[model samples]
Target: MTPGLLVQSQGRVLPVGLSVLSTRGKRELELPDRGLVVGAVRPGSPAARAALRPGTREEAFRGGVIVLGGDVITAADRQLVDAFEDLQSVLIDRKEGDPVTLTVVRGGQTRTVQLTLDASAFRVQGR
Candidate 1:
């Protein structure tokens, strides 16, 4: 059966509306070695507006099914991003409406996607 949910619903309120897996998370599962993996993209959000997609592949991790094979975010604004925290760290300092550059690997080919931060994006301090 295809898995579905409300939130990782853990982290959000940032600029983008998508769930991602850190490279280390995949490493634990012995999956592909790379940057943060795109897990899910919220509809109508900036991520969706930018055409970010989730993968068709699925794997069991920590008693839950994790979607894989979408896009791997290798960098952001020329800065290395190997984990969720890395991406978060980059965006947290930027204001909404600012343009951010993301480097993503889709289907073994790398590309850059640029999108302006949405007003709905915010951060929970002390997280």
Candidate 2:
């Protein structure tokens, strides 16, 4: 799929379904770490379908708390993800049903997992 698909569908949207944070910025905002952290995984989304895990611990951030220590996304499709935008840029041109390989670190163990983007995972608000 492409952005044209989004234009054609109007309210349909494709999403990874994971609340991801750039640990490089998170060091000052949340963790004293640097990497991409999975804060939460949306149920039934691609991330969830891939069995992705979220952080283990919870801490206050911006007056709200979210999971920490779950999984660190080091890369996607063999491309380095040093920031949230890095991942965004890599996936911007991708569409639903596109296959992706993710490098995830959990409990200090690194592993790769397969994922496929899904447009049905979400919709435009108020649609």
Local distance difference test scores for all models: 0.60, 0.59
Error of 1 at 46 (Å): 1.3
Q: Which candidate leads in lDDT?
A: 1
Candidate 1 has an lDDT of 0.60
lDDT of 1 by residue, 1-127 (tens): 0111112334532222223445677556444454666776667656677777666676654434556667767778888866666777888888878888888878777899887778644533231
RMSD of 2: 8.7
Model 2 gets an lDDT of 0.59
Give each prediction's root-mean-square deviation over alpha carbons.
6.9, 8.7
Top-scoring candidate (TM-score): 1
Q: Write model 2 residue lDDT over 41-90, tens digit each, in one string.
A: 77877888888887656554432344566776778899876465556767
Each candidate's clash count: 1, 1
Off by over 4 Å in 1: 1-32, 61-65, 123-127
Show model 2 residue runs off by greater than 4 Å.
1-33, 60-66, 120-127
